[model samples]
Target: MRWFGFGFNAFGQIYVHDKLIKGECSDAVKQVKVISPTELASHVDRSDCCLKTDGQIRASWSRRASLHLGGDSCVCLGGFGAVIASESCGISMKETPGCKDAFISELYLTLAFPDRIESWDLQKKEKTPSWSMEIKTESSGPPLNLPLVPGGYIATKPPFYRPLSPQLKAKSLALSAEHAILLSASGAVYTWGLGSHGQLGHGDLTSEEQPRAVEALWGMPMSCVATGGWHSVCISDGGDLYVWGWNESGQLGLPSRGLRKAPQQQSSQQAATGDLYTWGWGDYGQLGHQTLISSDEPQLVEFFREQQMRVVDVVCGAWNTFAAVVKEEVACS
Candidate 1:
């Protein structure tokens, strides 16, 4: 069986693929199914299952595949007699009363016989609610690379390609500007551009051209790394949380108003010490401190003192900081 996938990337390229070919193919093609919105609504119910006249609901065949049906795009499965709701090419079933008689953008239709290559041909049906079907075949080449944007990029390891060095494998598998953080398997942390207030943890007040390793963090072995708009937080293997970059709001949890142009050592004093520290500007409560002071050096913040909750994740936005902690579940007898 051939497995196909499609989606849009940060570079504005539409990625569509059929995973049965070797290496990369010189030409790739997509088959789409179309149907009228009125007819679609009658056949499929709000739950996305097909409804029989007797009210028996059957499972939808296109549930596993990604599809879009309304809003900016729409898709219908003509042969399967079903319509799907989607966004950005992924499939979801949402009831859209406005889309009652609208057009379907695209749909994935599986061919019955793969051995026989069938060409697409447009046909006109002699029926009311008149409509025409236009089918054409085209060749596709290798997938193209897209340009970097402010939000960054998301990617998965290609099945055919292997990293030349072990180091590359531990690198970022995917990244985005808002809330994506990556920690390589090797324990090193590399951050990309957009460190307005020292969020990149370079110990400097500049944005980086490409991915750069956090110097002071070298050899320490990072367990996790989190990125914010202008600041960054990281957790070490020893269960300590270190923060750096813009601290205008006490987000860095330190006292003073100097940006930490570098990574400061956070104390792992006790497991209950909170291990949280901050550096840089502090205008708002972002630093989680009493006064609005900034510091170039690392200062400790003692929030979460009683719980001593081990922070598993930390994320920063333009001016907000958030941390995720492990929650204990009560045992049921």
Candidate 2:
């Protein structure tokens, strides 16, 4: 698919498909659709593409364009905001009904595909927009190239929408894809979707509908977290390591044969003050436990202790755990 990037340059101008289009377009000439604040609870629908008001926060997205309100009571997407009017292609602020109290900062429009047109406005200091864009492009053919304001255009693709979790708040949050990691604001860790042998750390044999907090370390302050398709790991503020989920390959660092449906604290021998402990199923010694047995709880892998390492980060892949450890030096008299 062909992709294009467009937005405001240092010099405020509306560059469409890399070519300047509107210069100082009047406020009345534009129309913005404002979504009801109540609608925030509902799943964004593609039919709600337009913004009805000017200053009010609104959002719209399509295969070609994604719009967000700007801090200057203007609108911007895929680019910066507060464009000035000039002969080349500039945007200007003016009094309008949508933003009667504040001046209209900018208006952005995107044509991501042949038949898709999306637009919105940017208002000031609104971290979350009142509305969200609904992408509707769907076709087997390659994506389309749509023109944008300011400088570039974008190559659009068919929309990809995952159902919103009923348990999740209407606000913004992140989710894990295949091997990616997600750390929530709250230090608790959660994993889902796939758990071939127990990779999703819910401590059960089944997958989860949404994220569930890891209960074992509820009070422990977590600094970072990571997840694999069938395994998961987390680091505490005190530099301790905790693991759970799948352990078929000794990945859990334990000496048992089976999966752990709950987060288990690693044994003191397996977890020194700063040593990295692994547990789960260890088939290829991936758990560093030096054995090929499944562990139902956390265990210490002796090999990691000899190195006197302090783990800084841990990432889990489909079957491999990549850990970064800082080797500490012993002081001699």
Candidate 3:
């Protein structure tokens, strides 16, 4: 399997080894933006260490970290030539290999282990974790008490602790810098929080103080949902991908015009053709379109297709995107 990254490389967050700008000396080029999909090296500095395909890749505004697939260690790369490997810290990731099991913020890296949750303050540069807590688990089948994932329960940050309606059972949850999205067990999608850019998918740019159902997708049974800085996307059981919200960077995969307050028009919707696609926020080339031009509509990242590789999963950082792909096997007739 191979990993491809596109978007902001100002801090080397996307892992491109080539010079970002030509003619300008390497020392003179401060930031690099890849307008197209670029292959990423297994190691941040193009070192010999190999990264496993199943590892977790997490991105923040100016930093990127990847956890080894075995949950043994993680490598972090940051702006200004900052490279840190957590292997020496002796922090065990044995039970936190899942991508969702770890989270990275502007100043903190939190890992959800089977027995506890540990948080490290990146800015502090402390060898010991700033704080940690043991998780209580019931002895039995399926590990009764697992780390908090997007599900029936809701976890809030700071002053925003809105609860879901009593009757609504959430199957998954996604949160952005301003809004939140919930996928109910029944396949109904609900949203709340900041909606200035219409990330809530309520057909209006009104911030919802409480969780509200997205009437536009009322009868559509969605299987998965995701939210970006100021945009939202969901996948239908039938394999259709719907997108909405801020189009300034063409993250919605539509013709870039301006701010959009609703879901894309029918033609703008993308069908899940088993190919990796991206749009919007390409100022940093996070959309993987190969050109600095931000796409207002979903565009197939042809790099993978050209290489006969099938993308298995994708993760978005505040300013970058990483896709895990494997070689497609051709059946001989």
Candidate 3 on 298-323: residue-level lDDT in tens? 66777777778888878888877888
Two-way TM-score contest, 1 vs 3, winner:
3
Q: lDDT, candidate 3, residue 92? A: 30
**Lowest summed lDDT window (length 10), candidate 2:** 32-41
As a whole number from 0 to 100, the lDDT of residue 22 in candidate 1 is 26
Error of 2 at 190 (Å): 6.3
Q: What TM-score against the true fold does each predicted structure earn? A: 0.36, 0.34, 0.76
The all-Cα superposition gives candidate 3 an RMSD in Å to the true structure of 5.6
Candidate 1 has a TM-score of 0.36
Candidate 1 residue-wise lDDT, 183-270, digit = tens: 6668887766666666777777676665677788889987766554456778888999887765664556665444455675666655
Model 2 per-residue lDDT tens digits across residues 67-124: 2233433222222332212111122222111221111112332222223333233333
Off by more than 4 A, model 2: 1-225, 231-271, 290-294
